[model samples]
Target: SQQGEEDPQALSIQEGENATMNCSYKTSINNLQWYRQNSGRGLVHLILIRSNEREKHSGRLRVTLDTSKKSSSLLITASRAADTASYFCATDVRARVTETSGSRLTFGEGTQLTVNP
Candidate 1:
């Protein structure tokens, strides 16, 4: 319920073009993160954009967050076949009163990306 939901659950694209994915959540959040996971593997953290930040960049990846709309988007430019993976958006809900000290990341169903050569 509190987890973020991503759009375009499946995507197939050429190697050189860009790939875009969107995520939306229902509650206030401390931070939002993007992750990439290969088939049968653990997730690799890509970017962490805080609530105060509207946009962020890391290498060929760009992320934009809009707190007013409770939404975020990730863009991968000049994609390669190696970039193919399932991307997940994780959010830390600020409204939650938890005794746990560590981060409580809520992940969505993810958008599966396949970059063709």
Candidate 2:
């Protein structure tokens, strides 16, 4: 099965605010990565946390994982207008060569985040 599914497919916030989103998965994975994509732009890697870890942070981003529950959350603090983008969680699992691209990522549909300045 696919690894992650995020809730609240859309969100809106004012500048200098905080935004939080949750993701749930249904299988064991090697790692999970988050990515952001702005309108008409390519996706940018945000953060990645391995299954053995529980939490990780980068810049204004905070991510937490609960392996037991197969869930994860991303927190963006002191947001800015530039933060407006679509967020997606992708899972990485071990795959054999026949699996195609050899990338084990199964991406979610994504959460559209709009930050107003």
Candidate 3:
């Protein structure tokens, strides 16, 4: 499968600590995106890194992509209790040579993070 697989299926940390999660995927991809889900809520996009992008940052979130290794990592700096959520990595692969609408995203199993106050 072309879906991504996240490492460290679960994490527990106190408030103000940093949380790091890693994801690895099979097959070539057009882009990789990170998302966060709070308990029963739907996923919210955190960052999107194209195949050409090595790294990107948004607020306290940092995402890194290594196409050569087919892997990606997400770092949450100084996490708060509100940062508790499940993080997932999704991959967008090229569907076919003639398709132009973009392929559907395949999501990883996700990493559950618990930030205790």
Candidate 4:
């Protein structure tokens, strides 16, 4: 996988606690996006931070990107039971493509977060 494993394959926390997950990739990227998937549901787009960005926040989500390290982190603040889901970090790397190739988002192994009420 172009994307390396995410830290903490699973996390269990009580409601209101923050959940943090980290993702690392092997190559330079154009941008990185975070997604969430509820049980038996499709992935939901969360936040997309660009390679030039250091950090960004949306709602209760905070994302950080370090292009020098080829790594990114997702922080879900003030978590709730409704926020329990699998979170994935996806990286778009145009550098891997050839003239006939297309850019794609490579997803890392997701982190399953369980927020107990």
Per-residue lDDT of model 2, residues 40-92, tens digit only: 88989999998899999999999999999998999999999989999999887
Stretches of candidate 3 off by over 4 Å are 96-100
Top model number, TM-score: 1
Q: What is the C-alpha RMSD of each candidate to the true structure, in Å?
A: 1.6, 2.6, 1.6, 2.2
Worst 10 residues of 3 by lDDT: 93-102
lDDT of each: 0.95, 0.88, 0.92, 0.89
**1 or 3, greater by lDDT:** 1
lDDT tens digits by residue: candidate 1, 16-57: 999999999988899999999999999999999999999999
Prediction 2 global C-alpha lDDT: 0.88
Summed backbone clashes in each candidate are: 0, 0, 0, 0
Candidate 4: count the clashes. Answer: 0
Q: In terms of TM-score, how similar is model 4 to the real structure?
A: 0.90
Q: Estimate each model's TM-score.
A: 0.94, 0.89, 0.93, 0.90
RMSD, candidate 3, Å:
1.6
- Residue 112, candidate 2: C-alpha displacement in angstroms: 0.6
Give residue 99's lDDT in candidate 3 (0 to 100).
Answer: 56
> Between 1 and 3, whose TM-score is larger?
1
